[model samples]
Target: MRPFQCLIIVALFYCPLSAAIILTPTVMPLNIDKGGFAQFVITNNATATLPLEVSVHQLLFEPDGSYQSATEPAATLMVFPPAAMIHAGQKQAFRVQWSGVSDLPASQSFFVRFAHIQLTPATMPAGLRPSDTGVNIQINYNALLHVYSDRQRADIVLRVDDEGSARLTNLGDRFTYTNRLNFEAIDSEIQSQFETVVGDQFIAPYTTLVVDAGLTLPAGEYHGREIGF
Candidate 1:
């Protein structure tokens, strides 16, 4: 048997024949301000020209692992002209944003996924279909929830001098620091939340943890030290 065949037999995952389609961003688990926007680039590797669809959904996972979901409607972008099309050797970009919906919580974590996408031409002829027709893309983004708290808490407080900074008074009282902190970024067309992990230093419980960068931060109304755990 072929090497790929043997691996497929071992894994029990079927492989498709069409050329693979890939999506990439300069940075993923990409950080954006709560009410901010981010742009992503998508590239096609196949020789045929194709039209595409995109959509996004948000999922809220509680500390206990319970969850809720919000899915968006299907969206078809402007017809990709043949010359302006995503050729086998070319790439294109699209913009995505967080609507600033108040339902998101601060200092929390959730999953964002892409769902319901398929490729088609701006218009297909009556009886012609590309060998690579009907291909689909699915990807997801996993991000953290952030909220800026104004009220004073026993363990948490805002910094006096630094902007967008917070003070953590005592970490041992609430959070058990994890050796590994993992985050994920969602791609709407692919319906998958891909993970990316980063390293962290000491996050003092009572001392301050300054969050200066406006990235995928847990937004709004989190309990003191709840995020530490």
Candidate 2:
């Protein structure tokens, strides 16, 4: 399998509109040893019943800080109830399980997408009138799924350049989840110290992340701390 690399911005929940469908716990982590199963909840807040379709894709990250996904129907992961009908103000639960090899060499990442299926006049619920004067909106959500083994480890190295920029490299076989990065700079002539912090980021195995520390200092010696995995 190819290594996945991306800068993941973690969010608590997804709700794009007032009457949109809500998905909770956007990040799902599964352990391969202990059954490798997890569940997520989806709540329908719209006025009409929602028809949803679920699909699984292998998440891929590009060097240009973009994301792409490829469908893997024959993969080890399984999603229960690939299609669902959730009534307004009702909640549905979906199950995801890893049924692949028992001994995974490294961690894997996937994106489980929940998309709204448009309702036609023939498919609309009984007594529900199709909106003719108002705009209809559809929202889709993608939740991150991380499958890992107990022996997974992340080796991240932080390097600072002379121009006050920073680079993070992950040499290990697992993904590194970093919340913050701290760096200190010293100005010899002014005898002053400066510190900068970078926001949350993810570094995948065998990938390098170039980021700005958000601080510019005179040419001087600088040091940084490796982000905790």
Candidate 3:
């Protein structure tokens, strides 16, 4: 008999192909005025039992339009049942509460990581075993969690360099979410246009997000405009 092997897949966002586990409300918004906490549901769609581990991390962004996750202390946020074993077709409710300072002056962002642990015949329920192929797949998902106060607001500005490269800077006290950017420039009777459609992305406060304008133009000053905030 072949030994069962586990393959792990990590997805920054939700995985559509694997329905073994489903997490609802990929974007969770918590208002400080409304208790600064929220709930998320995880459903097991796989035929076999699933074990899940939950964790939270601080979300950070780089100037080059890239982002990373930083380790967050447990006292900053509270999650109930950080790990659980869920049966097939069963739904589990998880509660997240903010245990940090209650008087937050701005909005904060975090990533909720849900990992589906490896499965084996020994861990499976009675009468359940791996197929003859003896293979199991594990998946990890990262969900966005935003905690904001009443004073949260976004002030975004667009700037274009002499080479026509464009970047967006958020000067406000909170993050700005946008999906599209539109800009046009003119240099000595020559008009250059640039536009890009980026699916949901956020510009954190006091950070610059660089985007590919996809156009090369003569050296000149260009003013960029953002569409559909």
Candidate 4:
């Protein structure tokens, strides 16, 4: 658990039409559960009035691999202030609760999208700045999911040319860092324990220490349940 205070920088410039607002998570693929509760807080940093649409939509990937959404079409999730407005530089918080169960593919990742609309109203103040409508919007979503089997470990093999010849060694205490894989850690406490390393070369579990000339590669992608001593 962490106390989060994220600062989003959005530049507002003078424009003829409404300026496009940018919204995203500090990290990719904000995690949430299928049947859970989530609360999102939207901050209005523009110098003009803002009308935002709060809802969820099918996640879409942008040309450059970013994400964007305008609204939610017939989503089962319930959101507060379904259609509302926010003042310039002011902040508004909303709560959302989803009631459904979804089964994601094992060892796979997925994503969902939420949209916010900026609104301009006819109620004009006596003196309001006419600058770019750039505003920073941050989402704080929270969800709860039923815990599945919490004791599952994956046995991944790090091989060279798909051959069964490779070396293995642990990096740190309870943490095994290997090569050739970019793994993103979610809500799991991960650590690698260093087993052993033999000189510049690696030793295989129950295999020869030498003879092939070049040193064998490293294999540390496999994981298993920790057996209590």
Give the range where candidate 4 is weakest over 10 consecutive residues by summed lDDT.
1-10
TM-score of every model versus the real structure: 0.38, 0.71, 0.70, 0.38
Please give, for residues 1-229, the per-residue lDDT of candidate 1 as tens digits: 1110010111112123132445544223322334344555556665555344444333333322234444542131111221235565577665555444333223221222222123344323335344555544332322222222222122432232333332222322222122222222323321111112212332322333433333233333223233423
Residue range 42-94, candidate 4, lDDT tens digits: 55555666665554543232322233322434254566767557777677666
The worst-scoring run of ten residues by lDDT in candidate 3 lies at 1-10
lDDT value, candidate 2, whole model: 0.63
**Model 3 over residues 1-229: C-alpha lDDT tens digits?**
1110111223633433245667777878787778878888888887766678898887665545355568664457788889888887899988888988867766777777777755576654445467743766455766678887777677666666787776667777766564443435444323223323233466666777665556455554444345553
Model 2 spans with C-alpha error above 4 angstroms: 1-19, 63-65, 71-74, 121-138, 180-196, 215-229
Cα shift from native, residue 5, model 2 (Å): 11
| Count of residue pairs whose backbone atoms collide, per candidate | 41, 0, 0, 13
The 0-to-1 C-alpha lDDT of every candidate, in the order given, reads 0.32, 0.63, 0.64, 0.33
Runs off by more than 4 Å, candidate 4: 1-35, 60-76, 102-216, 219-221, 224-229
- The worst-scoring run of ten residues by lDDT in candidate 1 lies at 1-10
Best by TM-score: 2
